[model samples]
Target: METNTQTDQVTNYVYIHVPFCLRKCSYCSFFSVNFSQEASSRFVKYLIKEINLFKQKYNIKPKTIYFGGGTPSLLTAAQINLIISQFDIAETEEITLECNPVNITNEFAKELTLTQINRISLGAQSFLDKELKVLGRLHKADEIRNAYKLLRAYRYNNISLDLIYGLPNQTKEDVEFSLDEIIKLEPEHISTYCLSLEKDVPLFSKIDQIPADEKVAEFYYLIRNKLISAEFEHYEISNFAKSGFESNHNLCYWNDKYYLGFGPSASGYLDFNSKTVCHPERSRRRDHLIRYNNSVNFEIYHKMLDEKKIMIDKIILNNDDHEKEYIFLGLRKAAGLNLEEFENKFKTDFTKKYDKVLHKFNNLLEINERTIKLKSEAYFISNEIFSEFM
Candidate 1:
């Protein structure tokens, strides 16, 4: 494996994890807890200390910052600002916060916007009342509309709304109605996903009663047609964006660029020169900074941090590891990979290395100089294609 430190590039994206929520949704398996104003205040203090450590150690400055669940909006505006103040975020940086519509008010939206958090990703899930109840979302259908209207009234220009299909007892008409409602709002971006029944969640126990595959496919087709007609680009399998409105932060991940992930359950990756970088299936380097997974227990996290053993898992990437990752992560984007770039990373043509697999599955995967996107027919079976390399 190549070990050249000088040639490696530094990552400029930073992700901060906020693991507190007002309540747990049945479909959610992410780490989050019941809301506590005092706990949030204390968490912010530790967060700042952690950020300072990064600056002192690596001298890294971030160009994009993302604040993800559990219910980032549950945090007070002051606490959010406290965290933001620590980073020398570039003027053009895209800062995003994820929120459940129940906690979003006009005042809160205005305050967050003023604090330079220009983008808000509202977990709207659905606009149908019965579906919202079944999903255990606290917000009502009207509340979703009202909260979005409030954001617009507060002048939030970059807003993304999340919608879910494949709800139990849902029909084609119901999915279309959800898309219609989303189109009416004209959000800058729309993320449409199928309901995933996670293990140990309440929904998982009742998964058998969920919509059948045939109906689920119908709902997916309905969403594709509606959103495309509405002029939103189906940039990713699950993300739709208008022109110049694609999510830059998310793109960083799909493009396999380096990013910093902070907070419990958040993961970060950066390239290191001295380390032996292995692929995700065979990685074992724990220096060049750490892979910090914060605890679901904030108290435990605090105690661990004070003892300087807060890192839950850490792996440093070597050239070969980074090269393999370029294939897996790059394939996630709709545009796929650039052939020349792949050659530069691996010092070999990826197509040449996998020619046998490519030749055998030519009809199923689209391979070209610019990309290797899966055909629409092969999308649902992507795992089968991805496994060929391993």
Candidate 2:
């Protein structure tokens, strides 16, 4: 990591990347390695060392801690506890751990109850056996159900389930079946994703089987309507939650709050200062934001930590970069971007700054006195709209 400048701000949110998985899913593109007991144990030691090094530099009292993966649940409960012990987490803090349904054994779930992980995000990709097979998921449909029941048995009330739609050869009925199963389970939160085929993934070879954009739009509305009818708030484009159960850690990202990231391939955003820029033409205050990601290669990650050095790729954001990110990331929420907040933060009139772009898609946006957001009907093509700001 770069040396902390005099103005670096403290971050309350922490994300630890656990990059070990038994098998990588066919359509996944995240950086991860094959899981092994010896490797994971060594990774945990280095992860803790990395955390302690940061702790020495900053006073970190984490309000939310997230362990995201390549299947975070693959770590033993004792290992999870050891990493978590490095933080001073309050009972009210949201500590989330992502799990593969097949890995949520009875003993594992029971042991997790003893840890500070009060929330669970289960990767129950699909409830259909065929879809699971096509996606190269290790768990079957029954395993998803059993895992849910097991978590409930262990008293984990704050659970979120993940579902993927727009799969190869997927049908409206297939989506409905999965949604029906999800509703029946009644998790506190639900995150839905459209299968995106990356360049080198196995699913890219079968991209021809993917549904048309129009059909995918149909699926999106189908899901939004179903989840809304079931009383789940469509908080973000790809996330829905029951009352008071939103993922606090993820909310930090959409809300543009500073956070710290640990482990290989994890990225973090931090603000150095909130002072106005010294440029002659611009009068707006700009956040001195810096974003960095750890090395993706395991060997380099370990070597740097062993030498007490932080190996990261870093970027310092200019005013334009910050403004574009503010617009796009804020627009992801259902409540939309607050115009008042934007004008105050950037010291520019929202309408005057993006006048031409606003006129281009006037019908697709819902603008009012305090906030501006995309209309629900225009969500499927949101990326095209977001590009205007980019």
How far in Å is the alpha carbon of 285 misplaced in model 1? 10
Instruction: Per model, state how many residue pairs clash.
Output: 1, 1
Judging by TM-score against the true structure, name the best candidate: 2
What lDDT does candidate 1 reach at residue 153? 89
Alpha-carbon TM-score of each model against the true structure: 0.89, 0.94
Q: What's model 1's overall lDDT?
A: 0.76
| Clashes, model 1 | 1
Q: Across residues 10-73, which tens digit of lDDT does each residue of candidate 1 receive?
A: 5578888898888888888888877787888777877776666455444356677899978889
